[model samples]
Structures are given as C-alpha cells and as structure tokens.
Target: MASAAEQLAANMNFGSFQKASELHKRIWFTILAMVVYRLGTYIPIPGINSAAFAQAFGGQSQGILGMFNMFSGGAVERMAIFALNVMPYISASIIVQLMGTVYPPWEKLRKEGGEAGRKTLNQYTRYLTVLLALFQSGSIAMGLQASPGLVDNPGLFFVISTIVALTGGTMFLMWLGEQITSRGVGNGVSLIIFAGIVAGLPRGVWQMFEMTRTGALSAFAMFAIMGIAVAVIFAIVFVERSQRRLLVQYPKRQVGNRMFGGDTSFLPLKINTAGVIPPIFASSLLLLPATVMGFLANANLPAWAQWVPGMVGQLQHGQPAFMVAYGLLIVFFCFFYTSIVFNPDDTAENLRKYGGFLPGIRPGKRTAEYLDYVLTRLTVIGAAYITLVCLLPEALIGFYKAPFYLGGTSILIVVTVTMDTVAQIQSHLLAHQYEGLIKKSKLRGGGRGR
Candidate 1:
C-alpha cells in the first residue's frame, strides 16, 4: 500500500505546481537573483582598457583563463569586478573542512558543538575567503599592470582599486548565495555556479556551430561530440541515482500491551556520495596554481624566474601533466569527501542504539568495518567514473579545441543542480498537498461536531 506521502507524490502534476504559490515565489526570486549575478558579470573593474584587454584575452583564451572564464560566466574574460567569482569561498571551505578532520578542536566542534560550532566555522570560512580573495586579486592586479595597454593608469592606485573591486565582488556573491539558500530553492552556491555555466551554454553552442561553418570542426566530428555528450549525461544520471541498499532489521520488542519494532529497512548508500564536489574542487585546485603562474609570467621577474611562462604553457588545456593532475585530484577528493560525509562508525553506533543491525553483520565494530569496506569499493568505482567524465573534455579541448560546454564538469553541475532543484519543488508540492488534506479533514470534523 502506498503511504499518504507517496500517494500525494503520485498525484502531483502541473496543476499541483500551479497551486504551489510559495514555490512560485521562490523560483521567481531565484531567477531574479541570477539576473543580478549576470548583470554584475558585465560590470568591468575600473582602470582596465577594455579593447586592449579583450584582444589580449583572445590569445590566452585556450589556457587556464578560458576555464576560469567559463566558470565565472565570462566575468574573467571581461575583467569584470566579479572576475574572481566565489572560488575563494570554495577554497576556504575546503580548508575549513580539511581542518575539521585533522585538528582536534575543529573536529570536536564539527562532531559535538552543534549549530553554534557550525556558525563559528562558517565565520572562519568567510574570513579565510576574504584573505584568499585579497591575494588572488592582488596577483591579477599586478598582472594587469605588467601587460602593456591592458590598464589605463598602471600604478599603486590601480592595483588597490582592482583588489578592492574584485574582493568586494566576491564577498557580495557569497552573501547573495546565502540569501538564495535561505529564501529560494536549491543550494545557493551550486546554483550560482550552475547559472554561470548555463548562461554560457548558448554561446558555447553558437561557437561550436561557428567552428563547423568555418571548417575547423567537421560535421561528423560535431555529431560525434554531441552523441558522446548525450551519452555522458545519461551515464551521469544513472550513476548518480545508483545506490547500494544494505538491509537492516530491528528485533521485535514489547511495552505493556503494545507490540513494537520488528520493522525492516534498507540503508541506501549512493555510489557517488561526493556528487559534483570532487570535480569542482579538483578544478579549483588546478586553476589556482595555473592562474598564479599565468599572472607571474606577465610580471617582470628576476633572471631565474623566466621559467614561469614555460610552466604556464605546460599547464594549459590538453597537456599531459595537467590531465594527470586533474584526474588524481578528482580521485583523491572523491574518497576524501565521501569519508567526511558518511562515517561508518557513527552509522554503526546509531544503528546499535536503535536495535537495528545489518542482516548479516554484527551491530558494532564489525558492522563499521563492513560498511567501510563496501563504501571504499563503491568510492573506487565512483572515482573512476568521475575521472573519465571530467577528463573527456580535457582530451577534446586539447585535441579538437572543443567548446567548454562540452566539458563534463559543466554538464554534471547543470544536470545535478537541475535534479536537486526539481526534487525540492516536488517536496514543496507534497507539503502543500498534506496541508490541503489536513485543512479538509478539519472542516469535515468541525461540521460533524456542529
């Protein structure tokens, strides 16, 4: 028999969505926030010579700058105030999370400090973000000054102004993401990144078509690329939804005249527990070093520092070193993040406390070990899948000069974010249906009493 929630979900349709007034408002607010983000991407930082910078960017578009630009929705290409994007925040989050695992105090805060600890950690992340933004923006400012004709008045004033603009832009975006999470549907940070990638999809498609028209990309190759992309998307959806269900059984118990427990359930473990996080983190880590190298290559350096340009070249899209490093990072983060998200020991403890145990496993240490073993195997497969999906774009970009939209990371973000947002909408509709049922039942009961 279907439960009430399941029945409500089954009855959901377009009409139900229409009646979801709160969902509509949230969706509208999300759209408006995205519009604001897009607008900010077009507002260039002060002191940049737009024409000169655009021309210069054209040559470097195939490098790290290009990837960063894609992530920023062309903000980097335009030298906009928001050129830094929320990468600093992401990096800071990575640091904080890592610390939470290794540092005893942080680990205690994470494990037992409750909401207050989480807030404190968030404050720390914000502070770290500001510091990282300052460093990165300063590097970019120096790079801009180094390149002739890129800046209108290359001086300390310009550097200070650029850093202020870029850092402020980043902080504003972080705040905006928080607001969206509180008031809108879906994850605000992921949605911000998703919006950026989606906004550039049309341009990417047009560019691909343009390449085909110019004979740079053959018709057969274009079709093959599209087919591969479709296949990848399908594969992602399948893998993301795949789960390993561990059967758990609770022994029967009785209290007075009532009988309880003896219920069976399945503990579902997702194959890709890390989701799109591994790819995003990998990309951010790789981009940071490449960005610094690219900037330093333009700066006037000592006699021994001339190798910066060579290193930058080697780190460009399609390079063997870059591809290998990217794959490794993806794999590392997959396991690392999965461990952080799901603790087998905690799971075992909770199950034991509730008198629930895996069908064939003991309820304590053995269960924890078994769960860890299974999770490890699943993470291996998950890592391989993510590496393959993410590396395909690098290969295409390196060999065929494919558009950035063809990249697996972008597609993953788009698809995953879409799935999450849709699920949230459905949940909202389900809640609304429950409310309706309760109201109807209340009126009927009141009439009977009368």
Candidate 2:
C-alpha cells in the first residue's frame, strides 16, 4: 500500500503540486517572493558611476571580495542596492548564537523563556543587522570614493544616499526571508543564497572554458575536475544523512495522583551537528584580512600595504599553509559553534526532570559529562570530515577553476535543508493519508451500526 502511494506521488505532475491545495498556495507565495528578491538584485544604487565602478572592481585582483560578490550574486560588483545581501543578518545571528553560550543573561533567557524569548532574541538580531548594514554601507561608500572616476563627487550626498539605499536593501531582503519561511517552500534565506550560487554557474563555466581555449587549462583536466566535484557532492550527501542512534530508556514514576508509565526511545545524533556554520565562520575570519590586504595592496601610501599581497600570496590556492589553516579553522569552529548551539547540561537536566536516562549513565551531571564526551569525539570526526570534503576536492579540481560552490559548506547546506524540507512534505502527506483513513473507518462503523 505504501509502495502504491509512493508510485502515485512519483507520477504527480504540476497539477499535483496542488494535490494538497493549502500547501500549494504557500509554495506559490514563496516563489513569487523569491522573484521579487532576484529583481531587486539588478536595481543599482543611485549616484555611483556604474561603468567606472565596474571597471574598478574588474581591475582588482581576486580576494575575499570575489567570495563576497559570489554571495551577493554580483550585486556588490554592480554597486546595487542589495549588494550586502543577507550577510548582516547572518553575522548578527552568529553573534547572538555565541552570546547565548557565554552570557548569563542570554543563557537564562534561552533556558527559561519560551516563544517570547525567542521572539525577543530575533528582534535583537534584526536590530543588530540594521546597525551592521549601516556601518558596512558607510565603509563601502567611502571606499568607492577612493576609486578613480567611480564617484562624481566625494561629498555627504553620495555617502548618505549610498548608506540609506544599502541599509534599506538589506532590511527588505530580511523581510523577504521572513515571508519565505512563513509562506514558501524551503528556508527563505538559504534559498536566496543558493539561488545566487546557482545563477552564477553558467558564467563560471564559460570563464573556465575561456581559460581552456586560451591554453591556460587542459580539456582533460577540466573533465576530470568536474567528475571529482560531482563525486564529492554525492559523498557529502551520503555522510550528512548518516546518524548514530543511542538507546534511551525512561523509568516510570508516580506523580501526585497519576500513574505514568515510561517508554523507550532513541536519541539520534548526527555525525555533523555543526552543519555549514563552521566553514562559513572559518572563511569569514580567515579571508577578512585577505580582503583588507587586497584593498591595500595597490595603495600608494604604505610600505606594508604594498608588500602584504606578495607575502600572503605564498599561501595561495592549493598551497599547504592555506589548506592547513582552513582545515584547522573548520575544526575549531566545529567545536566552538557546536558548543554554542547545543547545551549538554540543559539536555541532561531536562532528561532527569522527566525521569529519563541514557542506558547505564546516571540522570544528572554524569549524563551531562557523558554527552559532552561523546559529542567531542563526534565533533572531531565531523570536523575532519568537513575539512576533507572541502579541501581534498579543492586540491583535486585545482585545474577546473570552477567556483568553489561544490565544496563542503555548500553541500552541507544543500543536504541539510533538503532533508528538512522533505521531512516537512512527508509529514503533510502522512497527515493527509491518516485523515482519510480515520474518516473511512468512521463511515464503516456507522454503516454497520445502522
């Protein structure tokens, strides 16, 4: 019967997108909202000389700016209003997540407060995003004035106009993300980022082919590199879905005037609990200085600025030092972000309060310690997995010169989000089937009684 249902779903067409009509409405709303986001990316900010700004960006050597441009879907290069994308929100989220681990006030709020506290935290994040957007926008505006012919005048008008425009863009993108989550199909913010990367694929491929035609790259190497990337993506999908399940048992207890019986359940721990955060943070920290260096590399004023690029270029792509630092950062952030996201102490306390235990482990501090210990080991493996998935293929596809979109972080986000979205769809489908079954059973019983 399940197989038949699966077959039916498989044969579903666009019409079946509305088989569950309410969910279909939500999906269409999300698509429409995403279209608005894509449209805004093309709307350039006012006052900047677009052609000059384009030349300035094009002339600069590749650095962190390239990655930033990738995330923004070329908006930064175009000096578009939405050039900042959703990065400010992402940064704010990271800050709030870190504070939740270290700050007592935040910790208490996380533990004791429910939906209200979450809403408060979210509000704070939004406020932080606005502040960050303003500062970053101002900096970019000043930086633009430094470029030759990029601005008509270095005055308050241009600075204020750019700042206001960029800030408004970031805020609008945030609202779109909220709409996607509430009304659309997948995660709004992640889909936004994914769309940017995907939209750049054709351009990246053309550039690589251009290199090949110019004799800078070999066709054989390009083929091999693409094959390797495909293999790596598949591997990431497999490993991310794998899990370790620990058997958990609950002891029955008498409470007040009620007799409650315990049941058994399993605690599922993923191999990679930190998800895409570790690599993202690691890249942000490691590449930020490189971005600064790239800006200063061609500047005339300072000796350090002129010499820095050559010094850092020693650790260029495929270099050992760069790989080592990237791997180590991935490992460190795996532990750090995991510690921020999951609190074993809280989990242990909740389990004890509910009369649950992990097999032979005691129900209090010991259990907490045990969980931490196990988690540490898993994290070590997880970090190593992430590093390998990101770096090894990076080494393999060194010749393809493809944008690093198929690496660990991208794969992690794609896999985790896909799993979550599929689970939601399955839940809806199951609910629909169950309701039909219940109705049929009721009708049968009624007919027999009549």
Candidate that scores best on lDDT: 1
For candidate 1, the 10 contiguous residues with the lowest summed lDDT are 393-402
Off by over 4 Å in 2: 1-17, 251-263, 285-325, 353-355, 395-401, 406-408, 434-450
- Per-candidate local distance difference test: 0.90, 0.73
TM-score of each prediction: 0.97, 0.84
Give one digit per residue, the lDDT tens place, for model 2 in 1-450.
346567555554555445677676776787788678778889998888888777766654244566667667777787788888888887787788778778998877766778888888899899999998897787677667655577887789998999999999999998888888877776778777767666676776677677778987788876766676677678777777878777788888789989787878777777888877776666655554554454444444355446665745634556677678888988888998888677899889988887789988988999999989988888888888888887876655443445555444555555666676666666565555556668999999999999
Give every collision pair in model 2. none
Clashes of 2: 0
For model 1, the superposed segments whose C-alpha errors exceed 4 Å read none
Q: Return the lDDT, model 2, position 409.
A: 51
